[model samples]
Target: MNNKLFSVIFSLAVAIALVGPLFAAGGGTALQHANVNVRDTAAVQRGAKLFVNYCLSCHSASYMRYNRLAEDLGLDEELVMDNLVFADVKIGETMDIAMRPADAEAWLGKVPPDLSLISRSRGADWLYTYMLTFYQDESGGWNNLALPNVSMPHVFWQLQGIQKPVYATHDGIEVVDHLTLGKPGLQSPEEYEGTVRDLVTFLDYLGEPAKVKRKNVGVWVLLFLALFALIAYALKAEYWRDVH
Candidate 1:
């Protein structure tokens, strides 16, 4: 009886120990790494440029229309045409990627994530952290899931530098001690953060294309209701004496 009780206690303790990190990082839910600064208009513009230059080739944001972006953002059609709009897509076309999913799985060992609803699905902080947290763990075979033996090689290693997550324990708490860049990337830390913020903004925009418009219209709707109520009250007062 004592041995059985010990086994149960041991199992419970092991389970708690194993699942602790899961809760800390949002309970093993979808990747929620992002530092999305949607309010930064300039940063969003910069991020759009960065994403077009780097990320658009693999992943497609199918829901967003170029025309929508232009109308909402007041973008110059000529500039987007010359610079950000690649793949021979028209100025009014929907955003899409050239990469096929089957080929991507063969190449990267997993399908690339869609960015359309990523901000909604994973949250901004998750996207931000994911962008920043990639590191070199030599054993990660194919797909990396904290399993050191990952096969997927770092695609952005050159841009972000080769990172290896430094692990440490203090006061019995394990942590991702640090991220050290072994090689140089195209951008510095501040530059990279801005870049990530840009992507986050874009993702946020994609997630809710009508958000800005809705917010702008919401105020007017409320004002209309208040004005309508005042007029209604005045009408009621004006009619009150007619029968009398």
Candidate 2:
């Protein structure tokens, strides 16, 4: 009944109201674990290569510089320029697409989104699941369980092959029970999964290049705080001993 108690209750209610939608949005299939490790330098390197080959033509990581990526992933400047640099861009330049926005819109009916911060916004698991769940619909177009009716085609179909969805009725509504490989691709399923994992790992790194450094520094900061706290406690006790 007091003003302070009423304010606390109102804050809690507002928090619940804001967070309710996130919980409600979990009605679809459970997201699979991405298991991305940004510390795996080889994996990130491979992911960077894959991104440049398959995704760079459409979606650009415009916020990230090629030289920065090389430094983070421990790649040589010349090697990056020779292999990863398809466009006539300098090593210090940002990863931008050559495709015009108008051309992309006309071709795909929508512009593909920039992926610099996609891992941060969508999470690694969602990206992993989205990458793997592409299936050939009855109409012969590509669809995904993670994002149904998406405009993006199965760009990795040659690597992952054709996947078909098994339908089952869920409360009188038909839904995909699971995906089965209808046709094998160039790589085995395990290989494809590993490739996707590597790509996701690279994306995770791109989202926050300083994440590992920050975590390492945080440990030292905590240790210093603990030591300081103990020292402060000892000083306080010594100062109060004579007074007591």
Candidate 3:
């Protein structure tokens, strides 16, 4: 019985491991391997700046509006328009990436991803870490899993400096350790890391643009549900007591 149970457990674990990531790969509502709390305002603002400068050329957060971001991030409309808004996108317009797939293919080979729901789809922490963890890859031509064989050059190199991979083997498991940022960029390592954090935060907000509303309303919703349940239980008790 013990051997049979072990065999079943092992088989189930192996099957799930093999098929799970494939099933869950592109489903929105989660970012890829990121854990995020959309409540962090500072992080979200930094993410917005990074998005406009580096990612806006290719990707678009089409579901969001500049005005909404300003309201959520506590920025004035003038500031958002002057600093972060791009390509003549009016303050009221949705954030749309101008690059079509064909256009992106012509240039960068893949359509830059839409990040509007990336937080939900991929998770914020995944974006946060991936943004910072890019390293020079001789194998894929550049090291990035979200993008492999990417024709797009490292856009953040000037800000992030360059990171080279250092490999360590433990128990036959290869691990990346303390990716060293070589040289200096427009932003120091600390500043660049903050930029990445902010970028991830913005993406997190995009994933659920109404997170604030949802969180705020959740308390009321729970209270109502609880009240209804209490009333229902009391009524049930009264009716059942007479029947009993």
Candidate 4:
């Protein structure tokens, strides 16, 4: 019976291991850490501005509102109305694009998805890495190290400059081993990395607006529990002392 049970458990474990990769999204190079901090209001604010300027043109954060940015990022309502709302949208309306779905599909062959929960879906690290890994391909198209043959062009190419993939033969197969920068962009590598980090931070916050508050509250709760545990231990000790 013990051997039969062990074999069954081992078989189940092996099956899970074999099936895991099939369910994983976007198999590619290892992701870089995003180091996102939702509590960093200034970083998140900068990220929000970047997203509005670049990503909002293609993707809509349909679940988020323009006025919410004013409240959360400490921006004035007038500024948000003037600068962020590029479409025919009111200040209080959700962040939606003006382009119709058919128009988007006709242009790009597929409609860009809404980005409100993208960070949660793709994870901050994957998004951060994907944003930075675009490389020039032979066909004049762009490819991503994180998601190979991706259709999206490097929209931030001006800011990030250009990179080319370095190929190497491994076990009789030529593969892109890494990327090498060809031209310098407006920002240095370190600066661009910082910018991407900020963007990821904002996306992370957008996925869960209450995360920072919950994290803060969790710290206080832990402290309270520690204090209560100490008090309870003391009371128990006192009660046991009389029994002895």
Question: Would you list the C-alpha lDDT of every candidate in the order shown?
Answer: 0.71, 0.91, 0.74, 0.88
List, residue by residue over 59-143, the lDDT tens digit for candidate 2.
9998999999888877889999998998999999999999999999999988999999999888898899899999999999999
The reply for model 2, stretches above 4 Å from the true place, is 1-27, 216-244
Candidate 4 per-residue lDDT, tens place, 67-138, comes to 887887778999888877767788889888888989988998778999999988889988999999999988
Q: How accurate is candidate 2 locally (lDDT)?
A: 0.91
Candidate 4 TM-score to native = 0.87
* Candidate 4 or 1, higher TM-score: 4
- Cα deviation in Å at residue 97, candidate 1? 2.1
lDDT of 1 by residue, 15-90 (tens): 9999875665552324544555455567667777777777777778788777777666767887777777977899
In order of TM-score, best first, we have 4, 2, 3, 1
Please tell me which predicted candidate would have the highest lDDT against the true structure: 2
Task: Give lDDT tens digits, candidate 3, residues 143-167.
Answer: 6534334466777888887777677
Specify the poorest-scoring 10-residue window by lDDT in model 1. Answer: 141-150
- Better structure of 1 and 3 per lDDT: 3
Error of 3 at 56 (Å): 1.0
TM-score to native of every candidate shown: 0.68, 0.83, 0.69, 0.87
